[model samples]
Target chain A: MSEIVLSMKGVEKVFGAFRALGPLDLDLRAGERLGIIGPNGSGKTTLINCITGVYRPDRGSIHFQGRDISHIEAHRRARLGISRSFQIPRPFNGMTVLENLLVPLDYCHIDGSKEERARSVLTSVGLAGRISHPSESLSQLELRKLELARALVGDPKVLIADEAMAGLSEGEIDEVLAILLALNRSGVAVIMIEHIMHAVMRFSERIVCFETGRLIASGTSAEIAENPLVRRVYFGE
Target chain B: MFSIDILLNAIVTGILLGSVYASLALGLAITFGILHIPNIAHPTLVVAGAFFVYTLAQWGLDPIVAAVIGLVPFYVLGLALYLFYSRVFERRGGANVLQSLTLFFGLSLVVEILLVLSFGSELKSVNVSYIGSSLKFGALTVPYRLLIPALLGPVMIAAVWLYLSRTNSGTAIRAVAHEERALSIAGLDPAAVKRHAFGIATATAVVAGAALIMIGPVEPFGGRFQIGRVFAIVVLAGMGSIPGNLVIAIVIGVAEALVASYLNPSWSPGVAFAILLLGLAFRPQGLFGAAR
Candidate 1:
């Protein structure tokens, strides 16, 4: 079995009267491409938030590389090699695209020249030409790419791409998928939280489905596709 | 009708006065403008800084030299204050805006009282040989004290602008205002960045204080009159725009000088507000601010 990069055992999150996620256990292995799919408000975002340390789990523990990191702050977790892109891209305005990449590189204290690292990351995301352009001027496709680039700039071990391709066109979606696939091939693990069915199915080596914050099914794409519970909750069939 | 010679002198004097205003407003630009902290205590802190310079000046140190020496302690003070503020209000995610304002307001009052107790609230002035002199160029005569402080504004602004644009920590400070989460995700502690930025802002107070005392005498409550005027400069400069801050300060200075010459000298205090209101009514993003 591959080494587990991230493990959450019996994690839970509650908001006021509502239990947003868990009493759940999930594991992501090194270099794994895992997809989490659920309907809107099915706790996909809550789970991501829990993992990224935005919202600490109300119960249970999260272990990264076999150490309990349940109480670690979000930035500490990010420095320890977990990074995520936002559902709605939050680019720092009043900055050039190159400067956006430089922020993460600078904050993370990654050794090497920041400008060089930013240039390389921008190149990897096919945004090398737009380096000097203002981020506010970027198109939708460029914004999505910039989001992914920001997440990837830290050289994260596990990247939680939250709805990265949500509003993109078909061609744009494929472009992003190609980037993710390329990233996975380079030994980085990815946890994609997406609503788009085929893309997730095509990309994920393992798939998990959530309904009302509870995991109803987990399997390969074919197995999840055939799972009657997943169909009933997802398609209402 | 305005005489040409009087108008020219007023314009020159306004430029000089504007430079001093820019220095006074610089710290606020960082605290309230860039960090979004609404540090209402900033002017009072400037007064405190003047006291620091005054005490140091008694030891035969130049005001500028004393201000440089005073920067370290003020920075540490700012860092501690921000840490306290973040713990009490920011981390809790409750009533941050109103609570922070009240906290700083109370802090300002406390600082004022402390200054009064320590210095006896008497008007204090820094004495230097050059202060009594003036430079005469043809029909223009500029007082050395005003010219020296005026020069400090551009120098300080240039240094601050370069730091903000050219360095890594400076970039983080710029980004911290826009999105805390973004900074966190980038592997930086948002609170730490804010604390550092606050320290830099507070460090600026000493320099501003030096300039303030150089321009004239300062008492514990002297900052009270400047509260509205300094804020007007920051807002008119468009929040955190450093270079813009200097330009707007000069413009307001010129207007105030013109008003004092042609209109009523008493009305000069109101000139900044008048221009501020008019500026906001037209280009609300400020002269240099990008459209949000």
Candidate 2:
């Protein structure tokens, strides 16, 4: 097995009397492409939130690079190379596309001039030509690219993409998928939280499925596809 | 009918007055406009700054130089204020706009009361060589008192604008106001950005205080008269647009000066609100702001 980049052991979360997620154990290896899938309210997002420090897990611990990181603040984790994109793209509406990328770079502590890094990041995300346009004026596909660029500027060790391909067309989805594959090829670990079956299966080397806040299946894409529990939870088969 | 002399004087006076207004609104532009903190006490901070200048002037220091010397302590005070405000309100649930406004309002009153107790209600003025001097150019007359302090306003605004646009930490400050989570995910401590922004806002108070003392005199409760006018300028300029504040402040200043000279001094105060209302109706995002 490759070196574990992230480990979540028996993680649990509760909102008042309602249990959002719990007793979940998972591991992500360096440069791995892992996909998380579940129906609405199945605690998929909740799990991501916990790992990203948006919420503190009620039980269990998360270790990143063998260090206890479950309790660190979100920004500190991001500084430690764990970055996430929001489900809804939240670009600074007042800033230009290039400025959006500049913001994350400013915080990432990357060793380079801000303008140089921002321009390079935008170019990498295929946004080189639209640097001057206001962020709000970006098309839906372009917004996704900006969101990805924002996360990418940090040079994150673990990139948690939450619904990155949502509301994009089929062709756009492929473009995003190719980008993710390229990123993974460069050795950055990625956790793709997606609802689209084909896209998730195509991008992930490993897959995990959740049902009612519990991990129902975890295996390779082919294995997950063949699992009866996953089929029932996903398609009511 | 507007005569050439009247028009020239009004325009010159308006420009000078606008610079003063810019100084007055600069701190609020950062605290309320950029940081989204609705610091109603901003004018009071300016008043406090003016008093500092006055105290230094009494000790034979130039008002402008005194304000400069006071910047460090005021910046530190701003940090403390932000920490307190954040702990009491923002940390609880992120301060709602109305709640913040109320807190700042109370703070303003506390500052005003403290000033009254310390310096009494008498109006205080600072003396310098140029306070009574003026420049003559044909039909236009520009008072040195107005022109010198006025220059400080734009200088401060330009410096801040450059800082916000050209520097890395400045970009983070601008972004923190918009998408706080985005800042967090970018590896920045959002609260720290806000605190820095608040410090920047407070730092402006020192420069503006010097300008206030230089322009004329300031009383313990002088900040009360400026509350509506400064808010009007920040809103009219578009929040967080530092350069935009200069243009908006000048426009309002000219309008107020023209009204005071030609119409009535009483009408000068109303012009700011009128401009604010009109600006909001026409361009709610402000003249230079992106429509959110």
Candidate 3:
């Protein structure tokens, strides 16, 4: 059996009397491809935020690689191999593509020639041709790829891709999906929080659905597609 | 009448003076330009730096050497100041921009008062050997006092520019201002980067102070005269362009020198603002700033 790389036990977050997430239990096995889907404001991002240490969970414990990391800072979490790509794509403007990747490579203290690692990651994400190009000059697809390359440059154990393909067309979506899949094949766990139905369904091995800050459904892709609660949350039938 | 020698002298003096202006604005270029902190206290800090050099010079050290020695202390002072600013304004429920400006403005006043208390409001200048000399070309002569200190501006500016553009940590500093959250996501502490940047900015003040003392005497409130000009350079240069900072400083300096020579000396102070307004009217994002 695969080891449980990340486990959340009865986690909860509250913001100004609003229950943002949890009283929930979730787990991602090592090398697992998990999909998280819900309507907007249904706690998917909140859950990811808690996991990434953007917001400390008001109550609950988060364990990564058997170490409790509930109170660690966001950067510490990234250093410990938990990383994510933002949904809206926040590339460091006024910098070149290579420089953007160097931020992560520099901070993570990745064991390498940082320049070589940055180039390797850029090449992996198919951004090698544009390494010297300014970040603001990149197209939407290139920007998304740059975002993923930054996330991957840290060589994370678990990658939470938050809507990483929101604005891409079908072909562009395929390009990104291939990159994420290739990343997973190299022994990294992936949590795909996405709104695109076909992409999430296709990419995830096990899928989970959320509604009003509660985990409504969890199972294999085939089982989740037919789950009644998830169906109700999505189609409101 | 406008004599050629006077005109040429004004232009040459303007260039030298502008370089000195660049040294003064270098710190603000980081604090206000790149970090966007609106650190109005920077000029006062430069005044403090001059005092540090002055105190050292009282013991018979060269002002330039004294400033070099003062760099680390000034950097630490910057770190402490940034920490105080962060704690009082940033960490205390995230103060609004106006509130931060007020904090910095109030800080400048406090620093000025403190200097007055410590130094007794007397004008202070360093007794360097080169102060009594000038380098005479065929038709023009430049004072060594101004020339040496003026040279400090470009040298330090180039050093800072290289550090920011070349090093790994420097890249983090550049990235933190815009992609702070992304920087954190990339496993860097954004606060730490800014604090270091603030330290670098503050360290420049000592060097600027060294230059200021060489150019002329400085009182506790001497910074009051320079507040307008430094801010103008930072804005006109574009928020974070190091080379642009030097260029704009020279433009304002030459304009001021010409105004002071041809018109009233009082008209020189407004020269920076006039150019700033004119520069902004055409290039609102600044001359070198990328349009956002």
Candidate 4:
């Protein structure tokens, strides 16, 4: 295997009477594109939460770049190059586009002029022309770009797109996919937690399917699509 | 007969008084307006600050100097207060309006009772040379006490506004209340930002306390009278609008002064609520705030 950037082993989470996730193992190589697919409440969110330090796993260890980081706080993880976009685009409203990017650059401890870095990220996301526009003024596509730009501004080693394409039209989805591809090409690992079948299949080199908190299937997009368990869980008996 | 001279003097008085009100409400603009904390205890904190200044002023210290001295301690108090509050509420997910109201109301009472135990319920005023004198110009008589303290409101407002608008930590404070997770993604702890903002808010209480005592004597219960009006000012200005706080404060101040001069002084306290209700009916987002 390619040098693993993130390694999770036997990571399990429980909520009172329910085991939300794990007793599972997963790995992502540096600069790889990974897709995570699961029906609602299959523990994808819980997994992401544990990885981002939003919640402790209650079991197991997660190592990032050779260092165990299961107990680190969420923001510290972001500083450590683990960043995520919310399923619902959560742009810092009332702030201008440049100001939105500045929030991350401000705290990322990135060495450079914040204004220049913000401007450059906005440009990379094709938002250079709308730099000063208020976040509320952006169209759906633009807001999505802003969220990605926010994640990008941290210069994260791993970027999690949590339903980033939910409400976008097909054309808009292509635009976002292109951005993610470009980001991945720049050596950032991407985890596309997507429900859109075609897009995920197209973007992911490796796809994993989750059913009731366990990894039911793991393979290339072609293998996942053919997996009997994945089809039964996703489609029907 | 409504005398032009009396009218002018009342108008000037209202403007001066409005500055004082701005000083009082500036902290609220950050605490309630920005953070949405509904800190009903702020006025009482102002009273505590006044008493602090009083203790120092007894040794012939300037009220302003005393206010400056108390800033760090008051800031610490604010940080501790926010830490406790977030522990009780935010960490449990979020604080509902009723829960926050009750918490702050209880805190206000505690502070008031503490003030009583320490300083007694008696009225206290600081003795400064400028306090006893008034400036006369063109039929308007302005007290130096009001003018000097009035300047604090604009100065404080400008300083805070600049910090919030131009600085990095300031941006984090503004962003924390809106989308807290965004701050997390930005690598900032949301609770820390809120605590810092709350500390800044409480720090202003000392300056405003100095202003309050300079205007007139203050008792432990002095803040109770202001609670309603300061809330009205923050709401009417539109939440999170710094400049709007000053403008609305002045408008309410002028109206109250006009009312006291032309109508009844007792009715003056009602002026803020009256404007607040009417302003809300018209611009629910606030006079200067962005629509939610």
lDDT (0 to 1) per candidate: 0.91, 0.89, 0.93, 0.92
Candidate 1 achieves a global lDDT of: 0.91
The 10-residue segment of model 3 chain A with minimum total lDDT is A103-112
lDDT of candidate 4 over A150-214, digit per residue (tens): 99998999999999999999999999999999999999999999999999999999999999999
Q: What DockQ does each prediction reach against the true complex?
A: 0.81, 0.82, 0.89, 0.78
Give the runs in model 4 whose Cα sits over 4 Å from its true position.
Answer: none
DockQ of candidate 2 (2 decimals): 0.82
What are the per-residue Cα lDDT tens digits for candidate 2 across B1-292?
Answer: 7798998899889988998899889989988888888998988899899999999989999888898899899999999999999999977877788888889889999999999999999999998987798899998888888899999999998999889887878888888888998788788899999998899899899899889888888997888889899999998888878888899999999999899888998889899999999999999988877776
Question: Model 1: per-residue lDDT, tens digit, B170-284?
Answer: 8888888788897898888988899999999998889899999998999999888888998998987889999999999999999999999999999999999999999998989
Better by DockQ, candidate 2 or 1:
2
Q: After the best TM-score superposition of candidate 1, give how far the Cα of residue B77 lies from its true spot, in angstroms.
A: 0.9
Greater DockQ among 1 and 3 belongs to 3
* C-alpha lDDT of residue A163 in model 2: 97
Give a tens-digit lDDT track for model 1, residues A36-63: 9988888999998888888999999999
C-alpha RMSD over true interface residues, each candidate: 0.9, 1.1, 0.6, 1.0
lDDT of 2 by residue, A142-206 (tens): 89989888888878889999999998899999988988888889889999999988999999999
Which tens-of-lDDT digit does each residue in B1-292 have in candidate 4? 9799999988889998998999899889999999999998999999999999999999999999999999999999999999999999998989899999999999999999999999899999999997889998988889988998999889989999999989888988889869987788778888888999999999999999999999889999899999999999999898978999999999999999999999999999999999999999999988988888
Q: Considering the two chains of model 2, state its CAPRI-style docking category.
A: high
**B1-113 per-residue lDDT for model 3 (tens digits):** 96999899999999999999999999999999988899999999999999999999999999999999999999999999899988887666676779888998999999999
The RMSD of every model to the true structure, in order and in angstroms, is: 1.1, 1.5, 1.0, 1.5
Off by over 4 Å in 1: A109-111
In model 3, where do residues sit more than 4 Å from their true spots? Answer: none
